[model samples]
Target: MINDQLMLLERAFLNSRAFPEKRYYSHVLWAPRTGSVATFPGLSNACSSATNTASGSAAWAEVQRQLSILVAALEGAAATLRPVAEL
Candidate 1:
């Protein structure tokens, strides 16, 4: 189950990085007058605004943190699963 969850998180993280729109949880507007502007200015400032903040971005940051932890654990598990000849 843990492996399956890790795979799901890994796939999600890869997809987010692979796709242009998925890179940021907030909407990106391309305006000639304003140039390129982010609707929420990414997750770096998720806690800046109390009432007008983007909740999805904050949740995405937590998910990213969990994914990183899962990846490290999976790497350790993979090392243990390596063949004796390779160890």
Candidate 2:
């Protein structure tokens, strides 16, 4: 389930770059009006479990890898919008 959501997010991020005119992609990543950030409860659980077991180290590493990708994508998207926001 988490993988599915991540895939969707990745696609959205890519689409946002391909079509800068679309605002929905940005909305999916962030909602300024409500001031709410997207949350993944399953990801939180995986992160917590990561610290509890040495056996899950590989899984933890993968999670961290995916998270880094997501973060970079978000930062890129935000950087693009910064100029507009400033004006």
Candidate 3:
């Protein structure tokens, strides 16, 4: 439900050209040491949150986590859907 929306948004955000590219993917990994996108404070909190635990502070991380699940579902959906152009 809500997870689905988050994933789509995450995917788009990932592919977005204006996410303030930092260089390395590890930079993308949410953690206090590396910091986060200034414009995307939600992403920062999400990464700062304790591992495998939910927090009121890390709303974006929660969304990201949910998005990961949805991404898997998206992959499944993509597999099931036949390509009209190919047909």
Candidate 4:
């Protein structure tokens, strides 16, 4: 179960970071958004609002929705399997 939780957290984090082109877990890492934004230098502030803004991004919205669905599905599957596992 601990291994499963760790794997789920790993997957959730990777999905949250928006890196899905990976074919192998041993070869890919998630890039930090903070580091990406750190190089902006606070000049002009005219970067693409989707990647820069908090409330108007389609990527952010999809991440939220996908995570919610993932949580729901995982909980449902675990609930269904719990009683059977106990027996």
Top candidate, metric TM-score? 2
Clashing pairs in 1: none
- Model 1, residue 14: displacement in angstroms? 24
Model 1 worst lDDT window (10 residues): 26-35
Order candidates by lDDT, high to low. 2, 3, 4, 1
User: Candidate 2, TM-score vs. the true structure?
Assistant: 0.40
- Candidate 3, 1-87: lDDT as tens digits: 445545543443332211223333322223223235553333444455544565554545565764464455446555444333432
lDDT of each: 0.38, 0.46, 0.42, 0.39
Q: Is candidate 1 or candidate 3 better by TM-score?
A: 1
Q: Write the per-residue lDDT of candidate 2 for residues 1-87, one digit (tens) a residue.
A: 445455555454553332133455343233222112244322343456565668657758745654654576677555544433222
| TM-score per candidate | 0.33, 0.40, 0.28, 0.33
Model 1 regions lying over 4 Å from their true place: 1-56
Candidate 3 yields a Cα-based lDDT of 0.42
Model 1 C-alpha lDDT per residue in residues 1-87, reported as the tens digit of each score: 455545554333222321133454312111112113242132222223323546567555644553454455456556544445432
lDDT of 1 at 58: 58
lDDT value, candidate 1, whole model:
0.38
Candidate 3 versus the native: TM-score? 0.28
Per-residue CA lDDT of model 4 for 1-87, tens digit only, reads 655555554443333223243333211133323234442211111233245567757656654554454455456545544433322
- Give the C-alpha lDDT of model 2: 0.46
Give the clash count for model 3: 0
Ranking by TM-score: 2, 4, 1, 3
lDDT (Cα, 0-100) at 76 in candidate 3:
50
